[model samples]
Target: MFERYLAALEYPSQGGINIDDPKEFRNIVLWLEDQKIRHYTIEDRANLRKTGSATDWDPAYAKYKIDLGFPANLKSKTEELTWLFLYAIKLEYSDNADRYRSITAAQKIEQEKKSSAAPEIKSTNPFDKLDFTSPDFEEGSRKLAEKLGIAYHPDHLVSLRAASYVISTALNKEVLKEPIITGKPFPIDEGIGMGFENHQDLEKAARILRLLQIQNLRKLQTAINETIVAVQNITADPRTDTSLGKVGMK
Candidate 1:
């Protein structure tokens, strides 16, 4: 189902496409229109029109998510399938999906085996080596921070300092907006709190924000999966087998 779209994406005539390029963007738009005629059945003119205020890819997706319990009709099943194909193709062609496919099945199995046999490795934080706590580094940091125009409070966390440097670099490259940092004397989190602010180039800021959001979402999903397994293990009896086949020691 995703083959056609994925093929076009992975093997464009240019070998790759710059979406920012006008020719490339127009080519993709034409390809999608052509695909509709050749492969799928998106006959609805309203669906094809992007000028509308109400409906588009994101809106339709949100609608489908909320109306999940609604039964599909025999007549519109074809249309639904076409939409599904489009959604699946887009998802499968994304960076997230590419990352998911990075490891082969054999590599995964080998990794699992190694993980089971090897000693547990403590996760290392990248900020650990960025020791901004030292007094000697403070003066140099101040001078650099002043040059860059990014907010750099001496009391800020090392993690935050590193982030500031990254933002500063982005600001220097883009030269679009100043990086702003808002801090408060919170009761927790080392008594200083920080968060994302709308204080940089919109596109770049959105990209980084989305990346962080995706990371948090992945962590939340992992926590939920682990919690489910832990609950089942604790509650399930080893001697019995249910429709699920087995649980706990069983």
Candidate 2:
């Protein structure tokens, strides 16, 4: 996928730049490519050619390319290449989804059983407290719905699902111990088969992150309470600490 993205950018396959190196840089590649595809449309092809957002595209790609001794020129082919990249990404996602679905029902059941035996630390999603009606969230939800080709009525369940995807992805990146963004993109088709795999993976990650956070807090609170109780008991003791005094005096 990274190589395909590089090819779309007209980057050389043989060069000093290792396209698969230094995990952080690889993550940036994934994030950029995902953002581009999520925003792609048939209507924007003309606009892309006529006027492009170099401000949007240049700095990140150029930084990596320069080190590899490639020219930083990406403006002219931006539209053509973007379309190709989106096509490739969507195709690969479909292939992966098909492969994933081929697993037997028994295997899935066993896997679920194993997962269920694990301890669960339940917590309310921080997103539950958020004001979804805020302008920033509303605008984000709209863009997300448009990206996923979901109908965008504010009151609709589909819109809420889209909002959850956006929120979960953000939380998984920012809050999780192993951030999901540094990992792979969602694994299924975004539009037609969204809820089956792609959206499910993201939501599961988000739930794990929220639970981990709540569990950690509970542990910390327990430790603190224990420490306070110990201190109070020591303070209330009528006897002086003979062992400590003996050691200090000696």
Estimated TM-score per prediction? 0.22, 0.19
Cα-based lDDT at residue 238, candidate 1: 61
> What's the lDDT for residue 115 in model 2?
71
- Name the candidate that leads on lDDT: 2
Clashing pairs in 2: none
- Mark the regions of model 2 whose C-alpha exceeds 4 Å error after superposition: 1-198, 242-250
Residue pairs with backbone atoms closer than 3 Å in model 1 (clashes): none
Model 2 lDDT per residue over 1-250, tens place: 4454654344445643442343433433444444433333444332232223445344544443444333445444444334445654565556577775677879977986897797877678997777877888778777777876667984655697866776686456556666345677654233343233657777666665666697899999999999999977876675758766432232
Query: TM-score winner among the candidates?
Result: 1
Model 1, stretches more than 4 Å misplaced?
1-137, 140-200, 239-250
Please report the TM-score between candidate 2 and the true structure: 0.19
CA shift of 13, model 1, Å? 89
